[model samples]
Target: MPIVNFAVAVEKGKAHLDAGRPDLAAFLFGQVLEAHPTHPDAVNGMVSVLMQMGRADEAMALLRRGLEANPNHPDMRVNRGALYLMTNDYESAIRTYEGLLAEEPDDPVQLVNLGGAYMGIGRIEDALDCFRRATEVAPDYGGGHLNLGMLRMVLDTEGSAAAAEADFRRALDCDPNLHGAWLNICTLRRRAGDPEGARDAAEMALILAPHLLDYHQNFAECLLALGRRGDARKVLESLLQVNASFLPAELALAQIAVDEDRPAAAIAHLHRGTELRPQDPLIWANLAALLHRQGRIEQADTALDRALTLDPGNAAARMHKGRIQLAGGRLADGLANLAAMYDLPEVAAQSPFGRLEGAEPAWDGGPLAADLPQGGHLVLAPEPDESLTFLMFRFVAAAREKVARITFLDFRGLGPLAGQVPGIDAVAAVGDGADIPCDAIQRLGALPGLLPGALADPGATVPYLTPPPAAAKAWKDRLSALAGIANLPTIGLLWCPEGRRDPGDERALPLQQAERLLQVPNVRFVSLQFGPAQNELDELAQGGLVTRLGQHVDSPSALAGALAAVDLVIAVDGPAADLAGAMGLRAWVLLPHMPEWRWAQKDGAPIWYPTVTAFRQARAGDWESAVAAAARSLERMLGD
Candidate 1:
């Protein structure tokens, strides 16, 4: 009667397991094993549950015990074989599956299971053979088709999209409720850029099982591709409602928040996601990137450290951490980290994104131009305020001795500032004299000079130089004050840069909002901008809420000098913020929802600029919220 009771318990456990309640099934199976010490069914059920929970060692122990008691039990043997696969003990799994295959050669399920073990060990060809054979044995087996399709997806070429698509579709046809097949189909559709098709497939899968988190994430991606961002966000939110622990859903939510220019929300979502999935290297890497953008360098370091702990060999994490260290002026530490990465086999072969080849030094001064001479004298154009170049200079100063071997050449317009600054040899305009080969030329905005038809001839040997602190500071104070107005809160406004075409640039406010800022009591708004929008601002500022400074400031350093006298600087996506950062000036930066990589993924006050604060758009293409935040900060500042 006791043995019969064990049998009944095992039957109930099997039913629960089939229904996907592995925890409940495991509990019941444990009771059966307690009633009958050698109950094969209970032992198998527990092993399966433990394996699903990633407790591979415990599952293996149970399998061994089952084998000791009933060595020839086919189901126990199969379960033990499966447990080996979970532990990545592929050799053992294969041996066990092979032995069982001898006893039940026609068992299609065992064949499919063996295929999975083969795939886990990277034996793609063998796995394909097993799946194909399993399919042949049971023509209607949807799992066999799904497994075969997945293997093909990895090993096949991009050109084989049609084949992969057909296989996935066939699997779905064989078992209409097959979730894996549906997901794969959506993935294939996405790869082909058929966003609508992808969304439809994902929706179909979700209809069958609303609890599939992966389906929700995939559907969100599809919706984003289809330009249905609102719909995608709703789907992600619904997923979080169903399963708060869903890591992928959180990542999707963060992406949506960033899309809407809600960097604060994005940061919060990412933090929760990382906590739930601490072992996920991608999440950690992303969190570090976000923290760094917000200028929280120390926190970024800690996040990266955690990521490396989760995956010691994650090359992306190492590269980013190295860059962050370099940006933070930890020259030796950053360089050492970057150099150490070269020892990693994967990074040594190629960076996670690409080969880590050192950038080639540009040859700006040219004998090729023939009119150029080596070591030609030149003037330097003062570095732009708050530019990437300024950021690089801070790194150089902290690490100067280390980079002493590198040469420094100033551009012609910038020669005066170069003379006034600490380290420099000579300066020349791109067209000042005969083209010359120099060790370096500084400033990225000067990239036009190196273009094909620019003044500097091709093949000239010239290295580009980054900004020094004094040069960066001089530029912001000089240019920002050019608007020629007096008083506290001497606001510097830069709505856009000259020449346009910058994807990151945006119209900071509508004419109505610009008027509102001007109307704000006691705030002196000055236009230090250099763009065609002067006419529009003049029309908008006719009553005296704004002052245009472009005429007074001659160069970036002059602007920097002028900016130093101002109480506040407000800008968006230009060298001005970088200049303000270098000068340690109190500045507010208006960033689009999807900020550049340098700004990181989340919105926060950056660690790179102690005096700078960020205001992000609340949604894509919406500047209303950002302007309001600026207004609030200004009001608070005035009140204080």
Candidate 2:
């Protein structure tokens, strides 16, 4: 071939590079460089192709040869610096860029590259200065503004969020097609509680770069936040079809399945994810969580062990292991694992309550060195679950006897019910933020650990809560109207299987299984189930098994009255059972083979609820046996 054909080869290489065929580009450039060793275009083109192929060492050698041939070639020098940055040789990259800047002091591209090198080496302040200078030198440079905004986001201070938003907007103004800038704006808006704005920004990004996976993922997340879960699921499913090995898409599908109460589907998705990425501890941990929710304790433990083996310091895996052990009646082992979470730096950093800061050491269940201040101690309710509320009531009643001033901070608008508990000096809503001037604050769930022997021997049970007289009378009159139809015993039937998210929990007796209880000769069944389970009630009514009463039983006070009015309450282990125990009402709680820790395995009755009888399933997911035993018990109660 003619030596003049070297320029033709170089031209062909440039065409391949533009067509996104880096391998072909590299081959053509190699031919050109073989003929003309000092050809600048061919050398730079080969280096770019090598870098694209992740052959950084090869790219560096070629760049060195190119710079040796032409000592003043700026493009080859810049490529060399970029190769250093790619290889994570931040110091070398910084020195190279600094040398380039010395020659061309006001080069915006060099400044931006320098900023990236500084960021790679943790010199955040220096990186910010470089980005600022780059933006100032070229006011229309969108990349400079984008990098500046990203750094501000990482800083994450009080006013940094707003500043980041401004920089991102400026980047978009400079270049409307900047997809990265649009994605950042989407995230910032979502974090600021503007889901609609987030959706708009995400849509713009998707339009600009439809093939980008992150844009699709973030758009789906925005849809989820806006309560468009169906839409989110469709988007995620489409993403999975495009790339089945995409871990994020798999995890998102699992989350949607969990939310929709399809544990089987969630498990399937996680199983596929684990198969694809067997070493990912987070995927194994998520699988364990779903198994635990389904009451598969042994399987859940096995999954957690795999996670812990892969990542021993995983706080989420450790926490889950502790809960599983606790559910299996290993209290000491469980508490030890749970307490270790507080000591883990990763866990402490993630806690929304903030790290255990200040001069005062964290109260680790040790005896108080001295009495609390005159203002006494404040007890904050962790959540609004009925069981949690009742447990808090027990702690408050016990603490009031010793502490002079005990204040209860109720966050769930449970002040009305908490006010009913005697010895509470002040029952205030959390939003009130009334300064109680307490010496120390204790989370209500933490009280059990602080009180020695509290779990070992749960002391005498008492009626801690009662329905208001008016509410009780209203329910009584409501039930009296039904008395004329059936003079038999009135039993409140609660057949809710699981919480909203956990649709098919093993602890819940299926309505079909529960219908066997209604077969008992003379008993009136009233539905105590809540939420959007009217369809379930209508099915039971069609089968002549139960009557709906959920409409009248809305508030907690009303629920208490309904429980009080009934002759007996039959329910699974849920809020209804917790309420019955709190009110000291007669109840028969059906338990799964591996019940919650609160329902410790026993023979006759639970110590916590003297009037409640717990019937356990012989095997896991054997609600039929539990239902049969409950049926016999109900029949015997009617005979009595």
Candidate 3:
């Protein structure tokens, strides 16, 4: 080819490269290089094409040749440094950029590139310095400000969020189209608890780069943080439409499905995610969690096994496996898994038992009877859950006969409730400055484990709690007045389970199911159900099946009085049932198939509450059987 043809071919190659057609550009550049071997444009074009094609070695060789021909070519050196950075050769990229900085110390672009290389190599302090210097040298440069802001966020020290936010704002002011700066700002704002600001920034990022999946994800996360779950769901679903195999979007959608009680949809989304990223332990672990929630124990175990196989040190998977084992009644295996979790640093950090961190010798359940103080024992109450509190009352009652003095520490200010128990020397709120003298302290929940055979004795069957006399009298008088008009058996009905943490646990029977009890001849039903279920009470009243006493039954003392006034208490597994059982009332406690471990029955009744009859659901999530059985029992009690 003639020199003129070579020049034309080189120009065409450059045009094709600029137009994003690296393949055709490379061929044209190759033709030029064959005739004029040292042409700068042709050499640079070939190197760019090779780099775009991911042929790092060929690109580097071509760049070296170009530098050899013109040893002081600044563009060639810059290109070589960029190639090193692209290939993740951080040391080489750092060396090249540092060399350039030595010649042009104030060049913001070179400083930013060097900072990125330092960041790649985990020299975070050095990277920060480089970014700081770049921003200082060119205060108006939006890219430099952006890099400085991003590095500040990565540091994430006490006041770094404020600094990062300022820099990001500055960058956006300089270049309004800087989507990355907006994203970082959004994240920082979200972390700082400014969800509205985060949403605004995320929206700006999406407007700037609508096609970027990460921008959409950030927007969705911001929406979720702002509690706009519906909007977030739409955005996530739209993102899945754009890229179905996007693992993050799929995982988010699965979480949304789980929150919405759509377990099948959650499982389907997770299954698709696992197909897309089969090796990701988190995806498999999440799948296992959903399965565990559905009580698919064996399938959950299989999924967890796969997750642990992929990543042996997966803490979430290990914790989940332990919970599954416990739920499946494999106590030994479950405890072993939990012990493994206790050994894990991350797990230990999040555990409630983390406060037990020390080098003190751990206690196994050995003979510690001699360690019990003979004089005064201070019992620290567990969390204010009714079942736990009632259990504490039993332990206190049993220990009362043994210890000289027993002081109850009611953490949740249940003084009125605790006041009704007979044997306590005093009942004090935990933080109320009641200086009780005691020789020993014990957590209420730890009593059963501490004294293994003590609770199993049948002698512990007596009712330990009593209702306040005046309140009980008031309730009895009110009931007497109602009975004179009705001439029927007064039954306290608690059809709904209270304080449910998981929506999937259908322990609460539908009011329609309790219509069986209402249909029983000569029975007056009083509502013991509480907490925002007035609509349910109204529906029952409209049907003339039950009457509401929820307004009068407010305090724990009042609840106890109400329980004492009724002939029988038919309740789901909740505080109402526990209260009735504690008051020695005849409670037919309707239980789910998986009622809490404490409610485990030995002789058709809970061992903890001898007066309470256990009507347990035979199948998981099926309340009808338990409700029907309770109704039949009520019919027999009424002699109808």
Best by lDDT: 2
Q: Which candidate is the best by TM-score?
A: 3
* Every model: Cα RMSD to truth: 10.8, 7.1, 6.7
| Residue lDDT tens for model 3, 122-200 | 9998998998898898888898899998988888888988998899989988889888899998888888789999899
Give the residue spans of candidate 1 off by over 4 A: 1-8, 104-106, 210-212, 220-242, 261-271, 274-386, 390-494, 497-573, 576-640
How does candidate 1 score on lDDT? 0.65
Task: Give, for candidate 2, the lowest lDDT window spanning 10 residues.
Answer: 352-361
Sorted on TM-score, highest at the top, how do the candidates line up?
Answer: 3, 2, 1
- lDDT per residue for candidate 1 within 1-640, as digits (tens), equals 2435777788888887766678789888877777776678789888888876789888888878888999888888988888777778889989988888898887788888888888888888899899899889987888888888888888777656787777778888888888878888888887888888888888887777665567778778888888888988888888888778988878888878877767678888999987897778888888887776565768888999999898887777887777876555454455445545545675444321122112223334332221334333221223323354454443322222222222333433444433333333444444322234433333332333333332122112111222445645765555455554444467877766442335434534444455545666877777776655544665674446776665555566655655665678887756677667666678888777645433432135564565678887876566777877887888888999
TM-score against native, each model: 0.60, 0.66, 0.69
Better of 1 and 3 by lDDT: 3
**How many residue pairs clash in model 3?**
0
